[model samples]
Target: MMTDTTQSRGRVEIDDVVIRFKGKQGTVTALERTSHVLEPGTFTSLIGPSGCGKSTLMNAIAGFVTPAEGALRLDGKPITGPSPEVGVIFQQYALFPWFTALNNVRFGLKQFGLSKREEIDRARAALDEVGLAAHADKYPQQLSGGMKQRVAIARTFAVEPKVLLMDEPFGALDAQTRLVMHDLLLGIWRKHKATVLFVTHDVDEALLLSDHVQVMSQAPGRLIRHYHLTQERPRALSRSGNELLEIRDEILGLLHPKTMLADTL
Candidate 1:
């Protein structure tokens, strides 16, 4: 379990943030005056339609895209650029093909100035957490898609980041593999207690993994609803009761009103 002091470290305050992109047509607004706070050590998921700017909002928080109109603060400090304090995982497993799984995990640790032995030990432990310690010597090409993503996750967590930004990290995997990854991620989150902001289009996925699920509108995305789930952890798809089903229906209705209406009729 994390100490109280450490548990208090990852609060993210998004203050009326607006993001824009310049194109041949004109300046297009991606996010429109969005504001929300992710409590320390909590798991929050962002869900929306495609092109709804879910990734854009997450990228702004990661410091990869600067907000045009508002500020993003982490524990009261402004986020100006990418820092090791914030770790990002994308749908693509961004692993180096040449490096072994262990080396890839150790790469981020190198910047921390840990001794060689300590780095190796930490990297091995991270891989073990993700059930990949046995495959530590394998190169990315030798691994399956799931294994590659596991390596990417191990690499990110090896550095002990305060906030984890995952944008559909398991979207590319098969259904079974994605379930396994979900379990691995929940275990890691329970042990580390880092604030997590995950982006996904799956309503069940958001409900299964998140303490809070934020739904966004279509283009020029804005946060439309926030659902706080108070259910027990280790939730299974089979155990989605009436309450969860109702919430799921509401979210689906929000995302696809016409389809939901047609089904209702």
Candidate 2:
């Protein structure tokens, strides 16, 4: 979805990643030998059951969590820790309560050392891209849940991170709002050209928004399958073609126990 110039912004390589956590039950393997490469500026989604380490892998990419054994590289450089070039958007709005939407979005730009005017200009442009320019003066408490998420989105893209890691960003929205956010996300993604790795449990959402959907198995997660979607952008579930439905069914068969049972019957 990226233009030629910004196409080089996002390129990621995950090599033989293994993640583990310490629990009362002992060491828990969250992910095992999982690896993948995301091409520059591609929109990819990770879909799987809860606790299957989809978020764990995302956190690893965001530099929030370290892989017990593996490597993560962005643009051919090893990712040692969180950097301005990588941005994250969680399911929670995570907006500062005291800050206006405009200020919240502008906060990340301070790291760039832009003068007061330049920071405001970039932040305004980001808000405009997400259709929230008019609401810029509103605080998070004054905005709806959907609007709050839009501001979060505006904040992430304002700094133009090379890679955007989204952890179920629209999971908290209602059905109608989720659909609206899908379109909004695609528009901004195309415009910014940041390599996007979206994590979602919703099969339709994954297929609708991604160029490729990677499916992970239950706990001790591994890359079970990956589907490359052929549908054009601005996609809607109702208007999806038969091919899309077929792929959806196939992914469903892998993720849903009942569907998997029926497949063998």
Candidate 3:
């Protein structure tokens, strides 16, 4: 249940953002003049082929990479560096092997200036939210891949960030675990109403979870298309309806025009 205050907090504005990297040869462009707005509390997914700079663009938003050309703003403030208002979940679980699940989550809360008792309480609550309270004492090696990712997610969300940047957070999970995670994530997002920018290479995953799906071009990536999904939530991956299939085909065509053309012929 999102209140008015939380609903109005996480609007993200990307203004003419360009990213580049320096190499031995010269400077290589990663993202080219990309601009878009992620409305408050909405779920947006970035999808493109490999080497399209999907992760690069997301890193800029996370304040891990600085844009060469433009600025990224959140709630009307410029993003100069990582802030507690923005939380990131990476493809790797990224949990500290030495720490137990409870401590891993508590470690993130320590930076927020909470008392030790408060940190413990929040960490416990976060683990409970991710259904890992029973395994709070378990180390990273003791947990499954999905459980480890859940710990990472719990740590991020424990900070109560206004925006969430997830870079293929479920990529390492098994198919069944991924499906379960999708549902769990949606539930948490609905409860907290944080604006989300998810990066994924899987078209179905993008379509299933996103309120808006953004497709980028290969290499020096540029946003080529934006598709708004009006379908109801708790969506299945079955693509059972004509509308879902049509959107899927259109996105597949964009990713592989030659294959789509051959199939049509």
Candidate 4:
């Protein structure tokens, strides 16, 4: 386990998390004794090469997958199984094809046993926050890739989860749209300030969206390095190119350890 001598209001502590999936060919280890503490309300991005098990780690936190060894904690309590306090926004839209944008968010709220009017108001407000209020009546089929993601975001926000987990939310969008979505995400995060863990394979995207960009290794995913963004919050995605590019190079170097220089300079 990584020694974290610090504490935060919304602490997420993982200790000796090991995960393996049995397969016909052989047993595939997704992670090996992974451990890290996420500070309260911090934006953390998990970035690594493909098949590095970023999504697997996320599922563990969301309680979708159980670790073969070790444990996970939220606010000092061990987490087991799915918790309503955590919201998982999948890589795909994950929206009901027949439901309108408003209903999609409303459905999430309703699942929590909220009143009908309360659900509608909260859902409407979330959609408005994502600038999708005008399209509230539209179904997933009518929305664009970015719009569909906006619906998913609105749905997740309406329920007000303690931790928002996103896996490659913008991977399907075009380059320009992806940048725009990144800025939109920053705006929402600034307003809510919830603990967010985003998983992606894009180095620059990780740097652009995270306060801490954690890069994992190939298989049996493990943290190889963490790039801290001490610059500023509310950073512009379009403007962080140079600094993010340098960080991207650093992550790439770590991905190929044989080519990497000494860890500390």
Candidate 5:
């Protein structure tokens, strides 16, 4: 597709952000003074145990959640709320079942006040980029799980958002499909070069996909560990061997120390 690479401008700053929620029982601290800088056009992944606040932190970046303390900024401006500049993709392919793939993507462009022709053209190009141009007329029910996710991705990228926030997008797919999605995602990512913050529970997935992986500690999540991947890109799942395995084990141990200990025993 014909993405305007110049539109990409994602740079994020999380400064000592602390998120707390007042529940019926008590105030639960979801995140505690967690901070990280997401460089523009870089891919960052967040990984940790179930209750660890990875998703909470991602929501804060997406402007869906407010921090109890500190701040969040994109390119030096405070994030007040959700904007077209930041796009979010969740695990569920939230495409409209009634709409065709092309129209679904076009729906997102309507907010930009594009002409009818412009919207159609852009949407078509986005679907083309994801290798789904031929399926433009198909509805969600006509597509497979992976195809639906691609349409979802195409919809997000169609707007050319500066930042992309993803929550377990591939978690629903089978292992084979997940690997294929991984490659497809990386290809689209390199073309767009938007700042990406991806949240996942899979350590190997984090290692395979991100430029840097931030591991949050158990509940009341903190930035417990950071892994910077040195391997070159265009990496395949099969190519992820020794170094990635070692890092995966290290992250696994961090996320599941008690389990690792029991296994060693």
Candidate 6:
């Protein structure tokens, strides 16, 4: 698996990249001259103040946005557009409300026009992987926040994507639900071994789920700090205590100055 970036025995590079958004006022710089490297198979979490353009970076890598400057590549292939090779999961879950969980997973398989039976079998297996086979027949509205996210995770895995892009997938959940999702995500990541770049504002959430925490600055967003989590995988919430909180506070210390001031006062 991947490890520390500096000690990255195997390095992955992202050359200069810049992204802009058109606003009523004018074009806004969401990211600028941003560049970083990630080790293969590593889980990296992006954290920063709100409106820091974390999601923008995810969109850029997912090929939803064209960078005005530089490019992104993986395994040496330049990323120019969205491909099944990358799977993106957002805070909204993005599961169609009308489709049952099973149908959603099947929808991904059907993209290649697989037989109905094969699709059913694959969807079932993917749901089972996320411990949600029993809920396969349920629709998104019927499930709780955690279950819907589980279905989202199942759908992403069903496609066997090369990478998973997550934008605060658990930010909307309750504390208890968030912890459960953390365990579920780590289990799935360990099993699937897909490269995951998770974006979150929750410092503890990032520390809990990522192999590395990438702290970005506010607009004109760019990496300000990165921490390699040497902690073992499959680590649990109940299992983590003071040390985890320490890491969380360290990240908080590095958050945007305004956020720090707001938190202090």
Q: Pick the candidate with the highest lDDT.
A: 1
Alpha-carbon RMSD to native, per candidate: 2.8, 3.5, 3.1, 4.9, 3.8, 4.4
lDDT string, candidate 6, 33-143, tens digits: 888876667899999988988999999888898888898876566788987778999899999998999999988888878888888999999999888999999999999
lDDT at position 32, candidate 1: 94
Tens-digit per-residue lDDT, 54-172, candidate 2: 99999999998899998998877788899878899989989998999999999999989999999998999989988999998998999999999999999999888999999999999
lDDT of each: 0.92, 0.90, 0.90, 0.85, 0.89, 0.83
Off by over 4 Å in 4: 1-9, 234-243, 256-265
Q: Please give the TM-score that candidate 1 achieves against the real structure.
A: 0.95
TM-score of each: 0.95, 0.93, 0.94, 0.89, 0.92, 0.89
> Candidate 6 local accuracy as lDDT?
0.83
Q: Give the Å error, residue 135, model 5.
A: 1.6
Off by over 4 Å in 6: 1-12, 236-244, 256-265
Name the candidate that leads on TM-score: 1
The collision pairs in model 4 are none
Ordered list by TM-score, greatest first: 1, 3, 2, 5, 4, 6
> Distance (Å) between predicted and true CA of 263, model 5?
4.2
lDDT score, candidate 2, position 17: 89
What residue runs in model 3 are displaced by over 4 Å at the alpha carbon? 1-8, 261-265
Per-residue CA lDDT of model 4 for 1-265, tens digit only, reads 5544344245788898999999998988999888899888899999888889999999999999988899999877788978767888888979999899999888878777777788788899999999999999998999999999999998887777778899998899899999888888889887877799999988778877788999899988998788889766556545755776677667877766676445632
TM-score of 4: 0.89
Q: What shift in Å separates residue 10 of candidate 5 from its native position after superposition?
A: 1.2
lDDT: worst 10-residue window of model 2: 1-10
Instruction: Report the C-alpha displacement of residue 25, candidate 4, in angstroms.
Output: 2.8
| Model 1 lDDT-worst window of ten | 1-10
